[model samples]
Target: MDKKNLKDESILNHDDYKDQHGAVVPPLYQNSLFTFDSWDSIDQAFDHKTEAFIYSRILNPTVKVAEDKIAALCRGEKAKLCASGIAAITSAILHCVRAGDHIVTIKNIYGPTNKFINSYLKTKFNISSTFVDGRDVAEFENAIQENTTLIYLESPASLTMELQDLKAIAQLAQSRNIKTVIDNTWASPIFQKPLTMGIDIEVHSASKYLGGHSDVVAGVIISNKEILDSILMAEHELLGAKMAPFEGWLILRSLRTLPIRMRALMDNTMAVAKFLENDERVGKVNYPGLESFEQYDLGQNQMTGYGCLLSFELLTKDIEKIKQFVDSLQLFSLGVSWGGHDSLVYAPIISYLKELSPEQFDAMGINASLIRISVGLEHTDDLVADLHQALSRIA
Candidate 1:
C-alpha cells in the first residue's frame, strides 16, 4: 500500500455505530449456530422474521454487518456474500435463468465466467448463451431470442477493456422484459454502480479490490431484495456458497478505505500505462483512463474513475521476447488475480489468438504480445521504472 493509505488506515474506525460495547471493531460471530430463548422465538428465527441468528450457513451477525455496509456503499437495496466470485456469478445467473433459457453476454468476460455459463450451465440446464461485441447496442438487441431471459454484460469488457453503453443496453433490456447482470469487478462500486444506471444485478469479486490485500477470496451480489432472496434460494442455499464470518470480517476491514486505495492505485496505473504507451515497442494499451482508448469517452460517462487493471501489446510476436519481458519484471509478481496491494502479471494472451485470421484477431482487440497488468500501491516511479527496465530487455 502507499504511504498515505498506510497512515490513514487507523485514523478512522468504521465499527463505532455498529458496535454495542464500544469495541471499535465489529465482533466476529464465530459460532456456527445461535440459541433461542423460547419456542415462539425459535420459530420466528427459522422464518427469518427475527434478528436472531439460526445458523452461520444461513445468517450471522458479522456477515450481516458486512453485507449491510456493502449494500449501503454500492447503493443497492440488498446484497449477498458468497464463497468466491464464481459462486456469486453462477448463483446470480441461475437466479435469472431456467431450463431451456437463453442469455446474451459480452464476448470478453473473465475466463471462468465464460466457461461456467457456456459449458457448465449449457450442459446441465439446457441453457444457451451468445457472446457478442458489447460496444454495439444493436448487437445485444439483435441477439435476443424468444427464450432470452437475461442480457449479461461486462463493461470495459474484462480483457479488452471495451466499454458498453450501460444505460442504452439497460433501456433495451427493460423494454424487452429481460433483466441485466454485470460483473462489476473491474471498475468496482467505488468507480461504478450498474444498478443506479438501470442494470438489474451487479456482482463483484470481493477477492479483488474489495479485499484489497489478496488474502481473502470472496464475492458479492448487490440488487433489490426480491432478486437477492431468489438467488438466496436458487443459488446460495442449494449451492452452499455462503460467505463465512471471518471472510466477511476480512472484506469489511478492507472496505473502510477502498476509495483511497483505489485512487492511489489509479495513479500508479495511469503512470504505467502512459509510460508503456510512449515506448516504441508498445503496440496498444487497453486502459479506459487513457485518452487514446477507443471507449474513453463512454467510460468517463459511466464511471467516476478508471480502475487499475490494464492490458497492453508489444510490437512483436516472438515468444522468447515475451518471456524476457515478463521474467525481467522486478516488482510485479506473476499471478492470476488483481486489485490487491501487490502488483501482478499474467500470461501474454496473444499466444491463444493463433487460430484467428488477421482481421478476426484484430476484431477481438488483442494480440500475441499482449500483457495484462494490475497496478498496485507502489510508488509511480518505481512501477514505471520496473516496466521500462523489462521492456528494454525485450528491445
Candidate 2:
C-alpha cells in the first residue's frame, strides 16, 4: 500500500495480515522468546545479519505491527512502542541529552513529564532545563544556551490549552542545530503531523486517543530510522519498557476505529466548548476550536482539528462552589486522563490545591476554579444538558 497517498482512515486499515492464514486482523505473538532454528541462525540474529525476533524485550511481531501502523500514521520512518507515555518520553529525552546538556521546554507541560525534566534528570544526570511560556517563539529563543541540545514542546499545553508555533519553533531549533520533540497526544496523528512540520521526534501517550478506550496504557515514539534505532538500541532496551503483546493488540484494535472516534469527539467537544463559551457561569473556555481563543489562528495553521480535551474557568473561584458544580454533574464523570468512551471532568483545584502552592499554580496557569473536560462519544445534546444543569447548581 502507498501510505503517502492513503487517507487517514485508509492508512489504519492497510496493515499486512497475509501471514495469519488470511486473517483480517494480525494475530498476537504472545511468546516471550522466539526459538532459533540453529546456532548459525542465532549467531546471524545477534550479528544483525538476519531479521529475527529473539526476545520480547527487544522486539515482537505483535508490537512491530502496531509500531508500523503508528509510524505510517505519523508519516515517520520508524516507531517504538514503550510501556507507558513517560517511558516513551524519558527514552526519547535520554537519547538526545548527555551529562551537562540543557533543554528548553514549556511551563504548562504534562505534570509527570515536567517532574521528570525538573527533578529526575537534574538530580541523576546533571542535566538542566529552562521552563518558558511557549506561546511566543521569542521565549524559546531567549532560553537557548550554549549547552542546549533539545527543545521540547506540548502544543495546546496541558491545563490552559496554550499552543506553540510548531513550524516557527522547528525552524528556530533547526537553525541552532538543536533537536525538537513534541508530545502529540492531544492531536494524535489524525489531527496533526508534527514530523512533517520539521519536528525531529514525535511522541504519543497511546493510553489516550490512539487507544480510544481506557483499557490500555501504552506510548509510542516516532521518528526517522536513525534516531529511532539509536533510542531503541540504547535507552529503550536498557530501560526494558517495551509494550506487552496484549497491549499492542489492543492499540491495533483501537486504530481501526480512531478516525471515526476522533471525528465524533471533535464534533461533541466543539458543541460543549461553544456552550461553555456562551454561558455566563464560565469565565473563559480554553479550546482551540473557539474563534475567541488567542491562538486559534496558530492552531489552525498547524492542526487539522481541535481535539476533545478542553478546560474552562468558572466565574467564581470559591472552592466549595467548584466542588458543588463538579459533584452535581451527572453525565460527565470526575476523573483524570482523557480520550476515552466516557466524558470526564477534572478540577485542578480539587486535586492540586494542597499539593501545589499558590505561586506554582499561577505559574502553570491553572486557576483555582478551572475545570477540564474530556469530551467522549456521548451524544452532544446530553453533554450540553449535563453542563447546563451543573452550571445552574453553581448559580
Candidate 3:
C-alpha cells in the first residue's frame, strides 16, 4: 500500500488492486443492490454514515473504480461516471446551470450536444445559451452576460478542430465569475488536462478512446472536490446517472491499453493527414498535429501530443463522389464513432454539426467536401493504400 512504489502505474490500472478472490483482474460486482446485516446498518448507510452500496443506481464499487481512475488522470479531486457521453455532458451542465441561468457555448460542437443545449435544455429547464465561434476569445467575452452561469467549450472544436486558448478563456470566465466546463472528448486527459489550465469541470465520452474498443458506451466528469462533491450530492445521488458495473469494469480494462492504443492511432493519423495534405483532390486538411495548421503552436502549448482525430475536404462537393470514396475504402470502416482498433470514416457534410451551412462552413474553414477520418492501429501502408484507392475513384 506504499504510494511511492505502486508498480509505477496509474492508480486506475487494475494491476494496482487484486480482486477479493485474489484474481489479477477485479471481479465485476454485478449485483444491483447490496444487503445489510441489520436495520441499524441499513439506516447508517442510508444516512451516508458509512461507505456501503445501497442501490446500483446511486453507487457501485465497479463504477467507483472507473470514476476514481478518471479523476486521478485529470488531476481532479473527484470524478463520476455516467451511462453515455451525452449523459456526462448533460449531468455536468445541469448540475451547475439551473432554471433561468444562461450558458455560452462554442458553435461547432457535437450535434447532439448542440441539440441538447439549444432545444432540449431550453424547453425543459428554461435555460438559454449563446453559441459562438469558440476560437474567438473576444466572442466568448462578449457573450458573457450578468446571468451567464456556464461557459462550455469543446477544444479542437468538433469538425473544424479549432483550438481555443484555454488559459485566456478560463481567465475570462474567472473574471466574470462564471463556471467553465469543457468537453475533453477530442483531446483525452493524456493530451489535455483542462483542470490544470484552470477550468472548473471536464467531461469525456469515455466511449471513444477511453474504451478504445468501441464495445462499451461510457462517460466521465472530473472536477475539483468542491464541484465534484456538489455533483455527487445532486447529480450522483438524486438524479442517479451512474454507470453500470460491467461497463465500469470494461472501462478499467480499456484504460490499461489506452496509452499504447492512442500512440499507434495518433502516429498513423499524422501520417494519414500528411498523405491527404499532398493529394490534389483534397481541398484542405484539419489536424492539429500538422505544422501547417493555423493553431499548431497553440495546440502544442495546450496538449501533450496531437490526437488521432483528423478531417479533410475534397475538391468536389458531390455527395455521390463522397459516397464513392467511402465505399472504396477497404481498411477503414464506414462507422459513426472513432478511437477503436479499427479505423473509421464519415462525411462531415452528413455527420458533423447539423446546423452548419455552406456559408457557415466557409467562415469556419470547413468545406462541403470534408471527410472526418479517425485513424486506428492498422498498418500505415494499408491505410494509405485505402486512401489512395478511395481518392483515385473520386478523381
Candidate 4:
C-alpha cells in the first residue's frame, strides 16, 4: 500500500491489519520467541537473509504492526517502539551522540528528559548540554558548538507552551551537521509532522495522546531507516526497553480513534482556552490556539491544529489561591501528565517549587499561580462550567 497517498485516518485504522486473516484488528502474538522449523530458517533469520522474528525483545509481530502504523502516520521511513516514553527519548538521544558530544535543547523540555540530559548524560557519559529558550531559531544556532552533535526540542514546550520554529531550526541544524530531534507528544502525528519539515527524528510518549485511555505506557521513535536501524541494534536492543506485545496492541487500538479524539479535544480545549482568556481572574492563557498567544502565527504555520493540553496563570501569585482554584475544579483531576480521556490539572508550583531554582523558573515562564489543564472528551458546556466555577473560587 502507498501510505503517502492515504489520509492519516486511513493509515491509523487499516494500514497494518489487512494481512491478519481478515481480522478487524490485528491479533496479538503474545509469545516470547518465534521458533523456526529448520536449521536453515534459523540461519537465514540470524543472517538477515529472510525477515523473521527470533525473539520478543528484538521484535514481535504485534509491536511491528503498531510501529509500522505510527511510521506511516508520521510519514517516516521506520519507527522503534519502546517500553516507555523516556525509553524512546533516551534511545534516540543516545543514538545521536557519543562521549564528549554536546547537545542544545529547550529549557522547558519534559521533566524527565531535562534530567536525563542535564544530570544523567553529564555525570555518566561525560556529555554536555546547553538549554535554549527555543522561541528563536537563533537561540539554537548560537548554542551550537564544535562538539555539538544534536539539537533537541519540545515545541509547545512543557508548561509555558512555547513553540520553536521547526523548519528554521531544522535547516540550521542540517547546515551544521547536527541531528534534530523533537518531542512531538503534544501535537501527535495528527497535528504536526516534524519529519516532513526536515527534522531528523520525531519522538512521542505514547502514554499521552497515542494511548488515549491512559492504560498503556509506551513510546515510539520515528525516523528514516538508517537512523532507526542503528538505534535498533545499539540503544534499542542493548538497552532492553522494547515495548511489550500487549502494550503494542493497546496503542494500535488507540490509533483507530486518534483523529476523532484529537479533533474533539481541540474543539473542547479551544472553548476552554477562550473562557479562561475572557475571564477577569485569569492572567495569561498559554494555549497556541488563542490569537492572543505570542507565537500564534508560528504555531499556525507549523501545526495543523492546537492540541488539548494548555496552561493558564491565575491573576494572583499566591500559592494558597492557586490551590483553592485547583481544588475547586470538581471535574479536573489534579495530577501529572495529559492527553487522556479524563480531564487533569497540574500545578507546577506544587511540585517544582523546591526542585527548580528561581532562575530556572523564570527561564521557563513558570510561576506559583500557573495551572495546566488537559481537556478531555467531555461536553464543551460542562468543561466550561467546571472552569467557570473553579475560577469563581479564586475570584
Q: What local lDDT score does residue 387 receive in model 4, on the 0 to 100 scale?
A: 88
lDDT per residue for candidate 3 within 1-395, as digits (tens), equals: 56533331456464566665788777799989999999999988978722458888777888787777777778887888888888889888987798989999988888889899999989998999999977779999898888999999999875779888999999999988899999988888878989999999999988899899989988888998778777777776777777889999999888887766777788899899999998887877999999999889999999988678888878888878888998899988887887778899988667444666667767865677788888888899999999999899989
Candidate 3 lDDT at 111 equals 82
Error of 4 at 18 (Å): 4.6
TM-score of model 4 (CA atoms): 0.97
What is each predicted model's overall lDDT from 0 to 1?
0.85, 0.90, 0.84, 0.90
Which runs in model 2 stand beyond 4 Å of their true positions? 1-4, 49-51
Q: Which candidate is the best by lDDT?
A: 2
In model 2, which residue pairs have backbone atoms overlapping below 3 Å? none
Per-candidate TM-score against the hidden true structure: 0.93, 0.97, 0.93, 0.97
Per-residue lDDT tens digits of candidate 2, residues 312-372?
A: 9999987789899999999999989999999999997765767788778777667888899
Cα miss at 136, model 2 (Å)? 0.9
Per TM-score, what order, best first?
Answer: 2, 4, 3, 1
lDDT of 1 by residue, 1-395 (tens): 43223222332234435566777788888899888889998888767732347878767788888887777667787888899998999888888998999999988888788888899989999999999988889999999999999988888766779899999999999999999999999998878989989999999999999999999999999999888877875678778899989999898888888889889988889889999889897988899999999888898999989888999887878878888899999999987889999999886454454545656755766676778999999898888889989988988
Which structure is stronger by lDDT: 2 or 4? 2
